[model samples]
Target: MSQNKKQKGKFKQKLTDKYRLVVLNEDTFEERFSLKLSRLNVFVLGGFFSIVLMGLTFSVVAFTPIKNYIPGYSSTILKANAINATLKADSLKVQLAILENYTKALRPVLTGELAPEEIDSLVLQQERRIIDESRLNATKEDSLFREMVELSDRFPLVSNMESNVKLVFFAPVSGQISQEFDPSVKHYAVDILANIGAPVKAIADGTVIFSGWTTETGYVLILKHSNNFISVYKHNGNLLKEASDLVQSGEAIASVGSTGKLTTGPHLHFELWSDGYAVDPVKYIDFK
Candidate 1:
């Protein structure tokens, strides 16, 4: 026990031993400065300085923009830009999907490859598939509200139902109807005789989904409106709008012409479709 105590005393003495740090002038042999320090004091001062340096480094990295320059760190601006890019990409994907569906639905109309009956069935099947895929379930209150609205607007001039608002169509052209809509004979459109180069207007506000020339229809312009309504203008001498263009109601979108092979003279072949089934344009529009 005595030997251990003596060893402890010697260790303590070594830690408490003083040392002098001196700076001297070489030529004059004069001490310019001196500092007295013990071993324990030197160790404490070194550790304190090291801790202070670490804290300063941490503050600079954590609180200042300099952290962006360090490895494995990203700038706030870069993060925001990445988020915006992702959102835009998602939006573009949705638009591309809508365009693709429009093209697919209009393909048979443009090509005349499918019968009208077959097209109607195809559209019905697509609608059924969409309904089946949707997982939304309306409450009883919602169903009752919808039924009330439908009943109230059953015979109104301007129906304002959500998702199925009744649209008021404008006269596409002032002319006499030469041929009426007769589905029994597979004639789903009306032929209106008009003067050549007369302005052909849009029936409603919509986006031009198709504007191109076909061998059977000549310059055909198709517009997609709200509530799943589509209007097709055929045998136009010239198209004033292009695909993806927005047109207002009664806006001149084409010129009257009997340019198609099926046309007999200067006239306009106008067709209206609702939820993919061809409807009589005369029921909703008065050309005169």
Candidate 2:
């Protein structure tokens, strides 16, 4: 107990021991500044200055953009912006994939690499829309027939009418012409005999207006081009282009096959119309 008490007294004595700190002018030997402090005082002052410096550094980092450089520290606005940008990029990727699929479907048509016609008739049933009306009464039928006759006379099926506007055309297929446009028998199109799975291309850049099957013409595709021109493709094994899709000239739209009741074999029935009138496709395209 006496030794411990003596040690304690010595420690206290060291802490309370005062020292004078003085600054003097070098040449004049005049005192400029002086301070009276103990070792305990010096330690406390140094610790206080260190704490103040640390607090100042923390304030600058927390209140300024410098905090962004630190790990795991981010502003709310910056984080939200990054998230939004990421979502937008993901959406764009999805859209790009759809476009790629759309373009890929047309490549085989242009390249004539077609799959076999083993697809079921129901494969595209969901895209088909058929409308059939029952026959009217005799009196009503006569009236309708008379109206149709008058309209036909006014329009008078004309063949090989020259287009007033100059337009470039892309050949839809490379095949032998089996049939020619003969409007007298109401055959307003040409037929080209091709391989069973040959690709059928578009004659011009256009938006698909119709893509579906019909009893008379199976798997028909119709595109509405510029300058009031419309192109029709019928009796296809399958249609690659869908309605409302924008297609470029020479792009594949379908595969040739015998799909309609009127078809004799795998062939493409192509028709070109100008201003609601059927024109000879041979006049515009060279599908040899």
Candidate 3:
């Protein structure tokens, strides 16, 4: 027991022994600085500095952008960009779907596949879905205002005529009507006997919604005008306007010809529609 105690004391003394570290100027042989440190103090200071260095390194990696440079770490900016790209892709998909549905709905009309009444019903259904007429009740003040406006505008004959005429259609071709619009026989168009290659004009300002050939209509050109008006020029010899082309009233859009299988001779087979319902073009235009 005494020998063990003696060895422990010597070990303790060695750990507690002070050492002097001196810096000297080599040429002058003069002591510039001196520090006294024990073995235990040096070990503790070295361990403390090591621990502090490790803590600094951890802080830089955890809180700073340097973490992105390390493997297995994701960049915050890149993550945000990825999320934004995903959202844009979703939006594009929705837009493409809407466009596809719109094209599908119009295909029948453009191809003349649907009956006139069916087309009208489709338009009516779409209108009903868009507007709730039950919620459009006019108040007493609104009725009174409408009455006042009507009374004030009643006496101006020319102004009244102009106001009543929402759309003024120009004659598509100056020719004698070979066939008048007779919906009872499913003839919802007027066949105007014009010279072959006669210029056919647009009835009003519109966009050419369809300009293509069909088995029954041949070279057909359909225009979509304001106020939900649509005009179709069928059996055309040639189309001057392509689809999506903008045309003005009285502009030549096609040439009359008996191109379709249904025609007997060269003539302009023109159909007019208002709000998806067939309208007699003779009532609105003077073909002579």
| Best candidate, lDDT | 3
What tens digits encode model 3's per-residue C-alpha lDDT throughout 1-288? 999999999999999999999999999989999999999999999999999999999999999988988998888789999999999999999999999999998898899998889988877676442223356689999999978887887576787688566667999999899999876577889999999988999999999999999988789999999899999999999999999999999999999888877888999999998777777888788999
Query: Could you estimate the TM-score for every candidate?
Result: 0.47, 0.43, 0.50
What is every candidate's alpha-carbon RMSD to the true fold?
13.5, 19.6, 14.5
lDDT by residue for model 1 over 116-203, one digit each (tens)? 9987898767654222213446789999997888687657434444324346788899889999987657688999999999999998
Assess each prediction's global lDDT (C-alpha) against the native. Answer: 0.88, 0.86, 0.89
What lDDT does candidate 1 reach at residue 57?
97
Candidate 3 clashing pairs? none
Stretches of candidate 3 exceeding 4 Å from the true structure: 1-149, 153-165
lDDT of model 2 at position 221: 97
> Which sections of candidate 1 miss by over 4 Å?
1-166
Q: Which of 1 and 3 is the better model by lDDT?
A: 3
159: Cα error in model 1, Å: 6.6
Instruction: Give the local distance difference test score of model 2.
Output: 0.86
